[model samples]
Target: MSTSFWILCHDLKGGGVIRKSGSIIKSIRQHTDAWINVHKLIPRDEERITEISNTRQRMDYYEKAISLREAEDVASLQEKLGRTLSKAEISRIGVSKLRLFLKELLRKRYMDSVPLIIPLLEKEYNNTTRKLNEINRELSTLDEVKLKEKGRAFHDLF
Candidate 1:
């Protein structure tokens, strides 16, 4: 049971923020029972993650650079960043490039269907929370027994 932490940023209008987030974390924590923290970003960071602001402008600049085959400029930019972009990083950027693509492909009716995804997410969170509570209870019991044993050993020595 390997546990991996995820930083999920969900759109606010979808509703069930507490239930969905809590349940998913709860379910996973049950199996591997790892630590996970889920948080809602402020509007500014949300805009940055969703590429709704200056981040979008930076993305556009990079996309134009790639399309033009401006190798020297790209190299300079990469050097300034102190690291080369991995394929995964580039793929993520390409996905961001598809924001407009999704908007164009999905009509208002389809956009309205987005809330359907929340239930599955909520179930996952609930299960994880339950498991975490079970694990915590077991640990508490073990600690109590250990403390009692130590007390008896000290009394016997006296």
Candidate 2:
């Protein structure tokens, strides 16, 4: 018999189904069960995966901005000092300390560039830091328990 016939029989009340067609009925029951289990859950899972991807991308951009700012600071310092300053030295001195030192140096010796460079660098650094903190808060709020329960792997989504 066609699946539609079985479906019609299933819809009718008191439709006496035969034992010979038990396998077909069971197959239909399994299909319905799978459809019900997966239908509503997948969209929610995909949404979360998208959220995770977007959050990570934002974090990466901020982190890269921070790194680029550090490199630019080091380059500027090296240019003014007329000596090589390794990135490792800047890291060892620490970012805030280095920025403070650079600001002071620029103010004392190269006073003209102070207005143009210091304010913009400070603003960019502060904005990036604040955005990174906001991204962290967003990450903390995101829950992956539902995806885990659904047997969805993060690796597969990436």
Candidate 3:
């Protein structure tokens, strides 16, 4: 079975699902302490993000995808997806949007608002780290099993 992975830069808010591209995932791996999630978007199919070129591109790809609304026509879609934008562009869009969202939510001025945000961020970081470690362990085990099976096969043949 063929497998694919996407490296994404997730935030305190929900993460953007990155479209797996060339070395983008590798770039992400080089920078950022981001945690990865293995998703089975389809039954019996799994995906992961291995590397990203840099933190900037990783952030940009994520922002563009998130900011992309439902394009009404092929022209609009092409315009949006056509040329690549710089890392700065991506970071600007993402940060601006997130700020706007937070501003709106904060406008409510609820009593528990500040307290709520802190715990949520902490929880997200904790969860992401835990998941990353778990995935590494699982992958290591799988590799060991494969190696053992290969050794057994060789012995049987001899």
Candidate 4:
């Protein structure tokens, strides 16, 4: 049977006993194509997910350094002032000021490396965050593509 006849028969508004062999085959092909495209995306998604995980690990390491350095600064500040400080008080003064105060203390005590370490940690943390955001955006695009293909296949059935 001709494809045009099958299409015309399927398109009839009030047809009874209309055959849809061609339409069914087309729908099946769409579904198969959708499945294949989605499967092709799987390895790329896995690699991006792994990259995100590694980026998060890098972010966590930088965050840990920030926390440790901040905590040490807080303890030193508290000890120097001979008083405990509230979290609000510590935060209100800000990290840069706290680091500066600690730098002065370290300078007086002849210790070194606070200035170098803080900047490096901040830069690394920011870079990791940027990388993570880019990866997430790419994954979102991939998911959107898969969704579009799946929608096309599903809706073509009717």
Candidate 3 structure quality by residue, lDDT tens digits, 1-158: 22234543233212244444524434455565443443323222233233323234554566576555422233353477896555545443533346545655676676558788889999999999999999998887787778899999999998
TM-score, candidate number 3: 0.23
lDDT of the candidates, in the order given: 0.55, 0.52, 0.52, 0.53
Q: TM-score of predicted model 4?
A: 0.26
Candidate 2: stretches off by over 4 Å? 1-109, 147-158
For model 1, the local distance difference test gives 0.55
lDDT of 4 by residue, 56-141 (tens): 34544655887888888888889999999987778735353554466467776664666768899999999999999999988877
- Stretches of candidate 4 above 4 Å error? 1-54, 93-158
Model 4 CA RMSD to the hidden true structure, in angstroms: 31.1
TM-score of every model versus the real structure: 0.26, 0.26, 0.23, 0.26
Worst 10 residues of 1 by lDDT: 46-55
The top-ranked prediction according to lDDT is 1
- Ranking of predictions according to TM-score: 4, 1, 2, 3
